[model samples]
Target: MLKPILKLLALCAFCWAFFASADVLTVRQDAPERYVVKKGDTLWDISALYLSEPWRWPQLWRMNPQIDNPHLIFPGDVLKLVYGPDGRPMLVRDNRVVRLSPRTRVTDTRPDAVTTLPLAMIRPFLTHDKLMTAEQLNGQPYILGASSNVKNATEGHILYARGELEPGKGYAIYRRGKAYIDPETKDELGHELNLVATSRAFRAGNAANNEPASLQVMDARREIRQGDVVLPSIDGEALPAYFHMSRPELAVEGLIIDTTSNLREFSKWDIVIINRGTNEQLQPGNMLNIVRPSPTVVDGNDGKPVYLEDSSRYQRLARNFGHEQITMPREMVGHLMVFKVADRASYAIVTDTFRPVRVGDHIISP
Candidate 1:
């Protein structure tokens, strides 16, 4: 009986040791690292590049006070990864600052370096739709005369008009309409303005010719503009420019595959969406950081040694078994960002980890 009891105790000790070692491994694997700063970048964008999650950037950033304004990282800043004597990756950046010379560029005066588009040719591409009403048109501070001096106007008819203080010679016309709303919530979002027609002044009239001229409504409606705002229209779809703002771009190497909002919603094969798109100037072959939540304090009493309730009756035995049992806080797991954006809703694959990632997990730009 004594031998059997000793064997059982040994087995329990072995199990505890194994689990403790595993926990340490998990912590080390999740530790942060130092990252070098490059040009055309900001701290917000940098943080998203290295860490599992971008929001937790404050943690790694707090480690470096030399960063001063958080926006001061310039090109050629050397970031070192410091570790403890135990070889464990400790806090990132010790706030050491190293500056380097800037890169110079060569200018080319060749014709290949310059391209121009004629205004006449570009005008067609620059037009956009606007929505308006007839009443709103009459209320406009600018009006010279109606087509054929008519009191009423209909769609597709060019109105001889003058603008406020200036003769309306080359101004485009549009009609304002109802606001757009969300299909489900019916919440008003934005106005759906439509373009009525383009107007060209045949005769330049004096500003004093404010006879409350009627403007032509290109698209006919039951009633003309009642209360609508008029704004200049652009010609065609606009392309997104390079995002130089402190936004994260693919900086390092990694793949994204999963995402989660909470432990209950965690999945290994979950999908994630990136803000980058073709319109945003993103292309194939870019990498981004997959972020996970930073470790947080869950319960203070956790990890404390505890004795079994049944053993409490035996004061001496309970005292020998220790005061309480300790359990570590639960850690939330997630994926890293990988893969270039294909469209507005590009998909990424979660590559690593045993846990699920949450929504709002960010992919930092490299």
Candidate 2:
């Protein structure tokens, strides 16, 4: 008789324990009680540093709709983090909201000077073009140098070669290369800039084989110097109008507000992050696409996968697998692209296994 009763008691105890350990949404405890907005600070950066994650900022801000625009949380605004019964974090604005009033000080007191001149127009110059074969030109190893003290060139910086390989008095130099990230994370955030440019070769090689050449800045800023890797310019027609302009603004749609788990592997065709929000233009139920990095293969014979080289055992396996001749110990895997976005950290799915989506997958722009 007691045996059945004891078993029933044990079952009830197990059920109680499960519910006790389960996480239920409640007010947070350690809410940031204070914050001072500074110049040039974006709400994204502040949310990441103060909250568990930046994407959660909307939830925190939703607690108080009177705060107005989320972007309006600008410099001089004071923020306060609050907590409720569940021990979750919440945000509040303090008396500092009134600091946005206009200032009376004016520093620029000088009178404005007006000058009007008809727009000066210069006639376009007409020149003859000539083509030279590879044998007609003398080629020298190019050395790149920089004037901005940056070891690696970035966007808008100028780069030039210091060797003698001249056509006329002044010819243009340009760079064309693909941009990628080191230790590739297969995430959208990991993508780095791949810059290309074209400029004129200035001072001719006057003295020795190692002499420097005079270079002039044409389009981009002239900062990079000899020893920087650059390719010869390619002659082409003008690019499309959209190529020179910024991308169009995307409409805010939906968001991946919550995730069931934190451990996720991102692959191709996974949703990453979304920019829309309640404050922006996003709402619930809108759909967004997830993107992942394209698959890359490495060979086994090579040492390893480096930025410029992919010589790994995996690469060899991939090659063998392509032929379908025999089975080798080669593995095919993918990468993830994470967008830390300064304050907001999110990831996109980079690999696809026809399995369940995980935490670190992408939620891309909609």
CA-lDDT, candidates in order: 0.40, 0.38
Model 1 lDDT per residue over 205-315, tens place? 445754433344444432223333323333344422111222334343222222222243444333344433454544432334456544322222436423343333444
lDDT for position 18 in model 1: 90
- Output the number of the lDDT-best candidate: 1
TM-score of 2: 0.28
TM-score of each: 0.27, 0.28
RMSD of each: 19.6, 19.8
Q: Locate the minimum summed-lDDT window of 10 residues in model 1.
A: 112-121
Q: Evaluate residue 18 in candidate 2 and report its C-alpha lDDT on the 0 to 100 scale.
A: 81
TM-score of candidate 1 versus the correct structure, residues matched by position:
0.27
Instruction: State the lDDT at 123 in candidate 1.
Output: 26
